[model samples]
Target: MVKGKLHSIETFGSVDGPGIRTVFFMQGCPARCLYCHNPDSWKMSDGRETDIDELLHRAKRGMPYYGNNGGVTFSGGEPMLQGEFLIEAMKRFKEVGINTAIDTSGTYYDKNTRGVIEQADLLLLDIKHTDSEKFTELTACKQDPLFKVIEDIKEFNKPIWIRQVIVPGINDSKEYIESLNEFIKDFKTVENIELLGYHKMAIDKYKKLGMEYKLDGVPEMGKEVMEELRALVRFPGKEMKKAC
Candidate 1:
């Protein structure tokens, strides 16, 4: 039985994915994104270890809600870190006719990870920055896996929602936005593009965890800026048209 290290679970999370999602935040991430909200999930040691059977039992309770456009979402630190567990859990969800989605930073990509993601109905792939240099600086991870993740999603013909976090001064340049638009052009599976505004709500978490807050003086991202980005990168595919 494959067991996953779980950070937490959100019963009715509205923002992570489509519908009223039951988000399972899996533990462990290779990327150290400067603005990461769930820093607690970064460490593999911090979460409770559990198996697919236990997770399936919890997911089944939301069956009625699942019928009303709600289903299971696997979020992270980076859910790809627990690929085997996710594969098992998603298999169970598929058996019961539940929708499955994954919110990922795409920091880890391998043959096994590819296999697991092939079962996903929707993928919320986070593109921290369009520029490779800026992405490395922000997340301390390479860009190859991120690109590969996108390519793999396209190969599987799965639906994907490209999520970009608009951090002030980090990746808000007009040049970068154009670059992002071009970068996503090759992907046919991208159904929608979402520009998430930066927030300082996670600063307190950094302080409590005794970690340095990297974006301390940074201002929150505005709605106007988000709209600007959305207009710039009009992704190709069938739009879900539902608000997160």
Candidate 2:
């Protein structure tokens, strides 16, 4: 039996997905975002392990709140890191009539994770940067897995929510917004785009871990700026309406 390494569990998660979801934060991430709040979730060995049966039991306990819209969202350090576990978990979730969601960094792309992507009903993909040049500088790696994953998800024709963290002086320019618009418009399955304002809510965690927080002086992204970008991008799919 394949067991998943879990960092933590939230019984009532509202922002992760639809309705009220039971969120499972899996351990390990391939990319290191500058504004990651849960820096502690970076290590794979730091988490506890559990198989699908036990995890499904705990998640089932929250079914009352899940109702029609809510279900289970597997977020992470990059949920795709545990592809096998996610595949098995999604299978069980489907059997129990539970909606499955994945919150990933769009980093991992392989045969093992392909099934994980196909199984989930919803996807929360983090788009760090639209430009490949800036992407390498931001994530510290140059693998364009997001592009591949975007294409793969499009093939499945599943609903995906693309999330972009508007970092100050990094990805907030008008040029970048236009670039993002061009990149995402090709996807036929994008339901909505989430323009998340950057915030340094993880500085304290870095302090505790004795690691240097990269965006030390960067201020929190304002809603006004985010609205501006939203207007600029004007996500094209489905009448090119506003994002949620």
Candidate 3:
């Protein structure tokens, strides 16, 4: 049986998707986002190898709380890195009436990854930075693959929630937010856009892991300011709508 490297599991996650979800943080990622909280999930070998049946069984434990909207979310260290496994895993979940979602950095894609995309019921994709240079500086990866995968998403007509981390001094500006609104204007399938407040909560995680906390001195995004910036995003149907 094909197995996936799992970083962790959250039994009742509220923020990742529509409702209460069983979130699977798959291990391994190509992007090195400077403010990432789960830095330990970056290496696949660091994870516990788990098969699909076991994952489904564990996820089902949260079924009663899932209600109509809640289900499973395949998160990261970029879940797309384990594309083949995800393809099979998502299939198994859907066969049992569970709604499946993928929360990805949009950094990786290929044939198998495309299968993962095609099978997913919803997607939470991060648009790290719209500009190529800034995107590379933020993620240490090119923005090309994400763009390519987005084209496929368009073809598949997948429902997606676009997310961006609102780092205080980095990408927290009216100009940038407006640009973001313009960027996704053509994505009719966009269910909503989320501007997540960047926080320093990951510093301790870095300290424990002995990894350098790249955004060490940056302050967490304030709610008031985040609200102000969120108002600037003007996608047609989802203007300022929060991820449900």
lDDT of 1 by residue, 30-146 (tens): 999999999999999999998888888888887777665679999998999888888888998999888999888978886678977798889999998777888899999988898
Model 2 agreement with the true structure over 51-102: per-residue lDDT tens digits: 8998799889999889888999999988988988899899998999989999
Instruction: Give the clashing pairs for model 2.
Output: none
- lDDT of all predictions, in order shown? 0.85, 0.85, 0.89
Which TM-score value belongs to model 1?
0.93
- The positional error of residue 197 in candidate 1, measured at the CA in angstroms, is 0.7
RMSD of each: 4.0, 2.6, 3.3
Question: Where does candidate 3 stray beyond 4 Å?
Answer: 237-244
Please give the distance, in angstroms, between residue 164's alpha carbon in candidate 3 and its true position after superposition: 0.9
Preferred candidate (TM-score higher): 1 or 2: 2
Backbone clashes in model 2 = 0
In terms of TM-score, how similar is model 3 to the real structure?
0.95
User: Which segments of candidate 2 are over 4 A away from where they belong?
Assistant: 238-244
TM-score of each: 0.93, 0.94, 0.95
Best by lDDT: 3
Estimate the TM-score for candidate 2: 0.94
